[model samples]
Target chain A: MGEAIVITSGKGGVGKTTTTANLGTALALAGKRVCLVDTDIGLRNLDVVMGLENRIIYDLVDVVQGRCTVQKALVKDKRFDDKLYLLPAAQTSDKTAVTPEQMKKLIHELKQDYDYILIDCPAGIEQGYRNAVAGADGAIVVTTPEVSAVRDADRIIGLLEKEENVRSPRLIINRIRGHMVKNGDMLDIDEIVMHLSIDLLGIIADDENVIKASNNGEPIVLDPNSKASIAYRNIARRILGESVPLQSLEEEQKGVFAKIKKFFGMR
Target chain B: MNRQKQQYVTIKGTKDGLTLHLDDTCSYHDLVMELEEKLSVNQTNEPDGPLVAVHLKVGNRYLTPEQEEEIRTLIRTKKNLVVESIDSNVITKEEALGWKRKTEIVSVSKIVRSGQILHVKGDLLLIGDVNPGGTVIAGGNIFILGALRGIAHAGYYGNKEAVIAASVMKPMQLRISDIMSRSPDYKSEERNEMECAYIDDNNQIVVDRLQLLTHLRPHLTRLERRL
Candidate 1:
């Protein structure tokens, strides 16, 4: 059976949906059959992130509530050539429309076909969180370096640890600004990991291109030269048990002298 | 002593001290006479014994100041006797209830998450961090062994004497009784030391280092001794 991973963070706007989209696309590009499941229900955004919003005729709630079959609800990504699919969440219905048992049953069926099923969990440790984590075998908790975000991430990690199926959730430090870290204004990765005490899966630095890619309905992982895309591809490899060295975020912006030298072709 | 005089006054020994039960139905003269007789006999029997503090219980009756003074004078006549307290039936009942409330303590060892609230009916002893957006309300004092970045309302039930102590006390808002104080916007680098919050003489919430808490309430050391 394929591994079902839940992407969750207790606080909102910390890039849980973005991570799910990029990681799912990257995994598919690595020759894996990936199905991205959006479990946010009323606050669905994964469909828009994947550029599959128009193709979602039947959603997760419809499949769970017996309104449609899983195959009918699954939307194939045209860019991936049948390797990537998305099961979108219902825009009208809330999280309570589907129970944990129904989610577990749906995931069980999907596991028979897909290589990886990534659930985009909603924020907060409430009913939505329970439903998203109910069927997952592993979890990825994303968080920013801010104190509020780290505090909520700690709570999400605590909850994930208590689940029988979720094997020790990994941490993804998102939106890290190296300049701020160097200036002692922002928390470092070591400090966050020390506070949370979870395994580090990947770190995606703050990149303006990520926002542009999201606005254009494309994950950064689709672009080879984007720094954030490179980070997401590395994260996908790390998830597949590859020993990939972390990319240094500090060197992305070249100094003015180096830019001038390159412009003048000085050798 | 006559059977009626014996019924008017009764003396009992306890672990902490002695208890004197005075009946309101009897005449004041008889009550004083019987109490003096018991004290004289008790002093003669144990002349060199350790001093035993006496607590008087006047059932369903209010004693005039003169009558109360007479009882105190009679008990003090003996060298081995000392009056600890004078209580009426109403005060004794209230004290029993107060003791029951004071003995209750809620101990939680889990980290209080965001959007989670914990309300304790008595003193609270927490061994985990209270994250931002979390709230802890205690009727009495609150003791936290970890960082307190959330709202902690000690003395929730209007107990101004209650205190809140934490190892790393950078709370979003600290409330003692009805007074509330929010932490400054800038973070302090010296959070390694423990800090305590309590009501000051002006009835405002004041936070100081844990060691200096004794200066605010001198009886805190005595209470810690009992613990």
Candidate 2:
């Protein structure tokens, strides 16, 4: 049986897609056979982020409706085709086209061939969210350090716990600005972790390289030097059952102060 | 005469327990007579006395609340009686109100997500974090063993004495009774230090390190202490 992981966050626009893309790439790069299925039916972005938008002849809805087999709809990623695949969401239809039982059946069919199945959950705690998480063995909630994002993460965690079969969802704190945290101007790592109270996966420091990489349809995990890339790599490693220690706040603050003195002229 | 009265009862298993729906339209006294008659038949079938119970059903006929109470009192005295809704003669506001008085305490084992409000009347204990988008309003003291990082209101019914305690206390908003504080300016180490928040002498909610409350309390004695 393959392990299915759902990447979800209650609030929208908090890096669920970005985390899915980068983590899938990172996991595939680690040689695990991974299939990333986008459950956001109407607004399909996982395909675009994975740079396989042009190759999608069939989508998740077709597979769920039995119009096409899951193997026929599966899009092989050229860069990591041997290890990573994409089950793109249908842009024409809404989330109602797929039921939770159908999604579970689809995942179960893929289980014999694949080792890891990652479902990119839709935003909000509606029917779509339920369908995406229904078949997953576990879940990872993505959130930013902002109060709004953290609140949504908490709510998603609540929903996951209430689900009959879901294991406790873990947390991913993304797009964090280590500098603002040092100045006490923004919510810090401890605060976010304390608030969400899920198992700490790892923290991804805010990096402009991630934006540039996304613009080129490349994931930040490809860049070995970027802090966010390293963090994502660590997260990918943790998913593989490796215990990796997280970077300390003091180390993060050092860069914050250095940037302030150099960029803002604070002596 | 008592043995004759016990003969009319009937029994069947239900989700709650065994139910006995009496013959329809029978008067309360007539239903009692039939219940006794049924019970005598059951007693003869099983010589080893299995505790048999009786219930009466009136098909859509509304009886007075007093009649329902009399039946309830009668059944409660007997062993293993479950007067289900189908058999219940009538329901009164007073009886419904009694069920509402029963309180429950639920421990949130994990993060309470955003857009969800947990309104608990009794002591609320949370094992996990309270994220920012979530709100926890309790009528009693709130204890977050992990973290209280969301919007929290303790002693919600204007009770001045309620305390909100958390291991990591970086809440987005904190309120105790009428006092509301929403400045994200406080800075403390990320160590597992406990914090307690309450209103102080000047009527403003004050949050201090739980360990330093001894030194801080003497200076703010005018502030009321909520137990």
Model 2, position A143: C-alpha lDDT score: 90
The runs of at least 3 residues in candidate 2 whose Cα sits more than 4 Å from the true structure, single-residue gaps closed, are A247-267, B1-113, B117-227
Cα lDDT, all candidates: 0.88, 0.78
- Please give each candidate's TM-score: 0.69, 0.64
Which candidate comes out best when scored by DockQ? 2
- Across A1-267, the per-residue lDDT of candidate 2 in tens digits comes to 688999998889888898999999999999999999999999999988888889999999998887988889999988986899999999999999989999888888887788899899999988899899988999999998887777667767878888877788898888877678889888888867765667999888888898898878888898888888889999999999999999654443357768888687664
Error of 2 at A133 (Å): 0.9
After superposition, which runs of candidate 1 have C-alpha atoms over 4 Å from their true positions? A10-13, A30-32, A53-57, A77-83, A91-97, A123-130, A145-169, A183-200, A215-218, A241-246, A253-267, B1-107, B120-123, B185-191, B214-227
Residues B81-159, model 1: lDDT tens digits: 8889998855346655666566466799977766678888778999988877789999888999888978999889888
- How do the residues B1-227 of candidate 2 rate in per-residue lDDT, one tens digit apiece? 35543323456765555676654455668776565445444444433455444445555556677766766666654444546454544556775544332223447675566666887775578887766667898876677886676789987878676677788887889999888998457665666679988788898888878876556544333433222
RMSD of each: 9.0, 13.6
Model 2 TM-score relative to the real fold: 0.64
